[model samples]
Target: MALLDRLRTREATVGIIGLGYVGLPLAVAAAKAGYSVIGFDVDASKVERLYARESYIEAVSPDDLAQTDHLCAWTVDFEQIATCDVVVICVPTPLNQHREPDLSFVEDTARQIAAHVTPETLVVLESTTWPGTTEEVLKPILAQSGHALGRDIFVGFSPEREDPGNATYRTQTIPKIIAGDGEAAQALMEAFYGAVVETVVTVPTPTVAEAVKITENIFRSVNIALVNELKLIYDEMGIDVWEVIDGAATKPFGYMPFYPGPGLGGHCIPIDPFYLTWRARKFDVPTRFIELAGEINTNMPAHIVHRTREVLDRAQGRGLNGAKLLLVGVAYKKNVSDMRESPAMRLMQLFEEAGAEVSFIDPHVPQIPQMREYGIFEGRAALDPGRISDAGFDAVVIATDHDAVDYAALLELGCPIIDTRNAMAKRGLPMDLVTKA
Candidate 1:
């Protein structure tokens, strides 16, 4: 049967790569939509959890995972790609040391697919990257299979719009932005994605879809940088930036609220915007606003560290050196165990560099995992919030605001409190002892 016909009838064997956050939820969603799903990951532990019916991502419920286990299969083997009628790549595109687009993961996955992909199969790249990556990079690698695109095979690009902690949208609910290399690939892309998501928005080509994703992140990065700068200016003038934002947000049409934080976090906001910044360098185009936004956000953790030291010295008559500090949360955001590009790691390093000892407590993230920038803290476990010692602790910093934390207890410790998220103010707590950083 033709790939499009098989896809429409829910007879397609969907293969999803890199089953971390995006791929796992997509795998489960495909299975729930009555399609056979094969989730591929290099992490053996993830495969083991799949067999055990355990879900590592919050977007995928454990009960839903257990129910989908009958139709969904997970493995580390790439050889099974031949069995799939539709293959979707959902890998990471992190930045390199010099902060350029690291397309290594996408290139490696494309090579793997090229080795085992069969005729009449549809391949979609869901990883965020440079605009031309789908046609300019992936298509050439896929052509190595000796199958012509829009003839013997089909390929496309669909940027992932995954909001990890969002309560409103799921894989099935969010609108899917899809594009293909050509007309034949477009039909197949529509067949597969239209079956899985509530809405499928098809664009002219992969470049348009990729650009849409980049523009979205760029909007966020620039706005966040604006607010972070405002926070600094307002702090100097003794005006509450949060109150100003709240008042501005009351005007219905003109203003959309973007909150300032200790720093930028999550996979998309901190990293994806730079993909454009790096690509623009080739054309000699200057992205001054975006670059300034990146600089402001990047320096926020350092600013926070300096502010903490100043607040502590004023309140305790001592400095950061030789002080014991506790961090309220370590995850990227509230109520989620995602810490990709979180600012807490940078804060820890800065505090330690200033001769202060730092300990973190996150209800969601139990232990720090091995990250590229902060691997030295791999085995460190989160300190129990309830059992915190008041003897040596000089101050507590609220980096992330999870509801599970007992903020009142931190107040009881009789130390300076730096509220970066304004988590305390949101809860109607007194701001007397809390210093808004």
Candidate 2:
């Protein structure tokens, strides 16, 4: 009741760890809702940028950061978490080289929070992971603080549904799903998140909350893989996938359109589904759909490469082995700077391996930053009409269809193009110059 009173009266200080895409928006929303927010991160540069009211994420603007400056403080010190009344862990749960769940970030953040967690302090994890993670992995680590759960301290799991660059739904509008270890914890968390978001869904257990997020992403992964497979089949049957999808969408009763792309990209769709597959192995359950979806999605980049070679050979009687190509839009999705698990990286590597010189142009990303697995492409080519006219490339691959691109200009160049995203079709470009891959 004390915690609930503090949260209601706007006297509670909210602490959010890992000030990236998910955490930063949450911190801002909490601050805007009249709570003092402390954003914690290990990166010194990101912390420094936050203090200066600079936002690196596309969803959070610099104006939003400046407005929250009075109520928000960005820090790198873990001890400052002790001053917070509630702490939320929004860390990344990336997969390892073996495509298994890697909970190192979440585990490390829980250990840090345990060191400073006090009696009556509410702690919630917003990182997406497999079921039983909250109970099996985090609870034991947090118990080291010696404060009994639901009696002295409270804990919950609330999966983040942050969609970057989404104009329709902001952090406050998206319905949050929350589950707690006990009734006390559930009540406190529901009250806390309810203050910021428009709607709150309370599940029975923490594992169910974790499974909800995984299920949402798995549905997308499998559906996207289905569309990609259909795209290949329809292409072989001399049919346009975009036209077929449009006609099917007109039915409107039992259909939701999921477009096919070069491959799966972004932090969530490409990685989160596999966490379930890894956990299912322990329970002796076979996740055939998940494994098959992963296989199809993983092979998309190679398929795009093969289509590019065929397009080049059919158009100009030249092979991709010695040709020069330009890749348009290197980011994972449209109108965002995030490049995690982007298919463009794989396409670039495939082009280079086949002895072709590749250059990229992305309006959102002027220069490609350093990535964990992908090598950095040093020079960024200009996307202007003059440059496209001057640089004689064998073909152009529309990997990501950002709105800022000049689709008409690319078509006017009269060059062979592999339109993996159907941007050319959307722009009413002629089929003669554009090959729908």
Candidate 3:
């Protein structure tokens, strides 16, 4: 009741862990809602940028950061967790080498909160993870805080619904799904999130909320796989899958359009399905459809490479063994800088393995930062746009279609191109040298 009182009065200190795409926006929204916000991240650079009133994520602007100057604080210190009334974990929940759900970031964050948390503080996990992780994983760890679970320490799960680079929806606009361990936890979570977001949809348990998040992504993965497979089939049959989908879209009943791409990229759709697959195995249930979709999506990059090789051979009479390629976009999605699992990295790896040289140019990604899975190309910079004409590329592969790119310039080179996202055709560019992969 006291925690709810602080939340309703805007006197609560909201601590957000992992100030990336999800955390920063939520932190800003909560601060705007009149709560004192403390953003915690191990990346000191992010903290520095936040303190400088600069935002790295496109969703949060510099003006938004400036507006929160009075209420928002950024820090790399977990010791500051002791002073907060509410702690929300928004860290990455990526998969390990074997494609198993890796909760190391969430676990480490929970440990830090457990070490410094005070009595009667509310804690919630906003990171996407397997069902039951709140009660099974987070509560046991937070129990070490020397406080009662439901009485002194409240734990809950509120899955993040962050759509990077989306102009229409934001953290405060997207309907939030939340669940708590106890009745008190549920009420506190509702009071906290209801103040920050436009709507709060509470489920009976944390596991259901967890499923809600993963189900949203799994639906996307399956739909994307269906379209990708259609792309392959239509490509072989000399039909444009994009055209078919476009025509089908006009009917507007019993059909939704999901376009084909080079591969599944971004943090959610490509990774969240596996979390369910791994968890389902424990129950002796097999998610064959999900696993099949994963397999289909996983092979998309290779299919693009094969098409590039075909273009190289047809135009220049050479294989990919010694081709030079300029990848158009490397960001996981268009118009966004976040590339947690961009398939472009895998394409780079595959191109090099086939003896081809890969250089990428993305308006969103100026320099390839060090990634957890793809570290070999760390610190690699994007190609200079001015040099594209005389860059001597065998084929240009458009992986992501950011609007800022000059697709027309590549046409002047008279070089063959592999168009994955149908960016060229969509722009009314001639298909003389363009091959849709």
Instruction: Go through the candidates in order and give each one's C-alpha lDDT.
Output: 0.91, 0.90, 0.92
TM-score preference between candidates 2 and 3, better one: 3
TM-score of each: 0.99, 0.98, 0.98
Model 1 misplaced stretches (Cα beyond 4 Å): 389-391
Worst 10 residues of 1 by lDDT: 384-393
Task: Give lDDT: candidate 1, residue 420.
Answer: 93
lDDT by residue (tens digit), candidate 2, 385-427: 4587778888999999999888888877778989999998888
Clashes of each: 0, 0, 0
The 10 consecutive residues of candidate 3 with the worst lDDT sum are 387-396
Could you arrange the candidates by lDDT from highest to lowest?
Answer: 3, 1, 2
Report how far residue 92 has shifted in candidate 1, in Å.
Answer: 0.5
**How displaced is residue 77 in candidate 2, in Å?**
0.6
Candidate 2: residue pairs that collide: none
Better candidate number, 1 or 2, judged by lDDT: 1
